[model samples]
Target: MAETMTTTQTITVGARRLEVSWAGVTHVGHRRETNQDSFLAEFPLFVVADGMGGHAGGEIASQSTVRRLHDVVDSADVGRSAIEGALERVVKDIAAHPETTDEGTGTTLTGVFIESDDEGSRWVALNIGDSRVYLLRDDHLVQVTTDHSVVQELITAGKLSPEEAEGHPYSNVITRAVGASELTPPDYVTIDVRAGDRFVVCSDGLTKELTDYGIQHFLRQHPTPGAAVDAMLAAALENGGRDNVSLIVVQVGDSSSTEDVHAE
Candidate 1:
């Protein structure tokens, strides 16, 4: 069985109160015995982690990473430094875990966090592996994160086309990840936020079943975060969910109106 966690939050940034909401869900999929994926959809932080290694190790790696980030969010300080510090700790956490300290134990971390100041707000996206962050604005969709995978590298080198990389045996091989015996800081991108913008942070499990166009179609078909999430999950499952599926839908403001960044 799968579980969905939907949350609607209002965070005050400076003098402006921002209406930000997200809906998240995770499933083990048809082929997996256990769901090694984990996520955090709390205010100011929406992230997804895909654990790698064996069953227990994968779970530990993902949980350790997500739990550590949750601690940072709970600490009332959300920033690049805070996040990077927490992830650095996660490396130690995984290594410290007796059951999952093996070299094969690691997890891909990706997502976006809300950063606000007296001037307004923006989104900071971070990723360590193939998991992705996508943005939809003006009814257009774009992938905001570059995948860190061999297929991606091949595509970049012009040795493979995006279409040919779909099932290239190496499609699942990632270049970097947390708790992989090395400290690789996540790549960060700061995005300007708008009222009607929508963001999706998800594991490759979801992407494996949905193309970018399929994702865009569902997001437009369902307005609210929860509805969009439900639709995407169903479609993914119906389309032969071969791997664990996890996703988060973030909406910046009301659907009926266009808004701008503000601190009040």
Candidate 2:
């Protein structure tokens, strides 16, 4: 059976305290024989990794990548350099793994690392391929991460329109990924957090099936992070589950909120 996980946490950054409610879901989709996507939704960290290789290699690459992040989060060393160091280790580990080495496995990773500073709570959005991070603020949705893919390059070069690139045959061809090289440094940006902000991180499967407008519509309809996650997974399947789908929704609020953190 598929597993849907939900959790909440109260994080204190400097003098700012935030009660974060979050949930995640993963689906095998219609076309793929095996689900190669992996996610981590623990407080202070949320990530989605979409594996690309043969069946076995793809799964290994993604799982290994997340495992490394899991360790880093547990160690409570979520600084920029620490995250980059963990990713570097994963690249070497995957390169040495027999399963991935034989088939040339790689995976796209995108998500956020929450950290505290003198300024208050901040979110470090990270990306290393076509997977994406999006923000919803004041009822508006904005994509925060840039895709490192061939079609994205074309769009940047003014050679193709956004609509045209969406349907482009090379849409799935990513330019950078973990396990593809000995060193993979993700692109990241730090942003201040607000009480009403909502963040969505997902693999390409969700974007391929739903546009940004569609995602925003669902986020508006769902009252909580879990509801939004379910809505997205259902919409992807209804449209055409061409690839494995995975997503995590995180909502920020005051500590007085009724929601309490619980283990899955």
Candidate 3:
């Protein structure tokens, strides 16, 4: 909760170039003793992790994952392999550290990274748990990542509705994680980049307080990344910051010529 962190830079990939502005923020919140979330928002990648466990293992799990991810992204062109390899290293990284637990320590990893293929530059969103990535384009907001939690499974199976799943007893139970996988790997979604695209990469902390409508309203009201991030965090805390909050707001410049994308 210092001054809002903001950065604007030009990133070049292949023959394509993008002017990007981003802001990142994290808070311990009103109910948590330690902030169990970590994030890395750099040129080619932006990721958020929410750690779970006792005995400081949660902090270690989240910190290690982001550190390894930062190491993996120390290159010009980032792709799916880099994220997979980094996650693979996360296992070893946790093993080497005695601060972690066998079954208790794990993390929810989610984020968006820039990927370049033969055609052109694009966005690749990845997720392993309940953390989320939302894209706002042409005034429409879409959650690009799926949740791996118990309530989500029930909702998918038609056993529970969205409103019913909100306060469910199993809402906090995640079926898969980076340390303990429930026989599933991370999910990936590749998106074509546009100049006006805006994304929200966040932990459940932020979503627990803000509705999809609230998120879209804030993004629409604040065009700059820093302003949007600040507004969202303030709103989350005001509603009731029951969990540690963390998020990164990212935007691509030069939106004058991009076509409007409909929510499908």
Candidate 4:
């Protein structure tokens, strides 16, 4: 097998009205021939999707979901409600598409949208299935979105312990996904924004490999968004990256404020 590799990409687009930096990484797992995950940082829109289906249907589903999301965002300036509506619309469209419908292709998407005005910026997270969004504030990590999957539900109902859920046979069987039905509702959460807060959007691959302690330590140590993303990906691979891993790290506030955040 070719040696597993990792790469990073960063873009600084738009005016300096606000400082925004994001980093993403995706790796084809040791066992898979094609990567079925996708991550995007389209300025105000950041998304991560883990696709499922047969053949290359998974890949096509994830890519199509991202493209469709971009289209919706492009046509309208959306708030939290609008974002949820867009997600619902996309899922319906995916279900209606003949090629995808017959194959039952679907994907889990966790998206974060940030908007800024003269006052400041606000953020909301939209999620379907198990991909996650975590917020880091004052050096503490908090899971902002609930997983819409069978194992997660079991854990919630106390039928399965956190440790047991990890190895469950149905751990990957998601109960909800975009395009799973004619219309699927995303669990959207509006989070209070603070200047020093940071957010991570990642596939289950990273969370599965790294403990919360490991993630918080690495993220706290590497303040640079790109560097943080790289370190997280490296650590996941080091711990037997059994699945494709992808992550995006974003920090709030201006560059100077971000420096202050890490200086603490």
**Residue-by-residue lDDT tens digits, candidate 1, 1-264:** 343455778756545566787899888999999999999988889999999888698899999889999998999898888998998888888888889845489999999998877777678889999999999989899888889999999999999999999979999999989974768889888776666789999999999999999999999999888889988999999999999999999987743334532222
All models: lDDT? 0.87, 0.85, 0.85, 0.75
User: Higher TM-score: candidate 3 or 4?
Assistant: 3
lDDT of 3 by residue, 1-264 (tens): 554867998866455576888999999899999998999998789999999878687888899889988887785546777777778788677666777776568899998887766766677788988999999987889998989999999999999999999999999999888873332457888776678889999999999999999999999999889989999999999999999999999888763334332322
TM for candidate 3 is: 0.91
Clashes of each: 4, 0, 0, 0
Candidate 2, run of 10 with poorest lDDT: 255-264
lDDT of 4 by residue, 1-264 (tens): 332232322323233333556667788766567888988776678889988776676786788777777775787575656666766766765665656646668888996886545655557788889999988888789888889989999999999998898789998888888765665667777664455677899998888899878889988998778788888888998898888888888776543223221100
In candidate 4, which residue pairs get closer than 3 Å at backbone N, Cα or C atoms, i.e. clash? none
Model 3: residues >4 Å from true position, as ranges? Answer: 1-3, 12-17, 180-184, 255-264
10 residues in a row with least lDDT, candidate 4: 255-264
Q: Please report the candidate that would top lDDT against the real structure.
A: 1
TM-score of each: 0.91, 0.92, 0.91, 0.82
Candidate 2 Cα outliers beyond 4 Å, as residue runs:
1-5, 101-103, 255-264
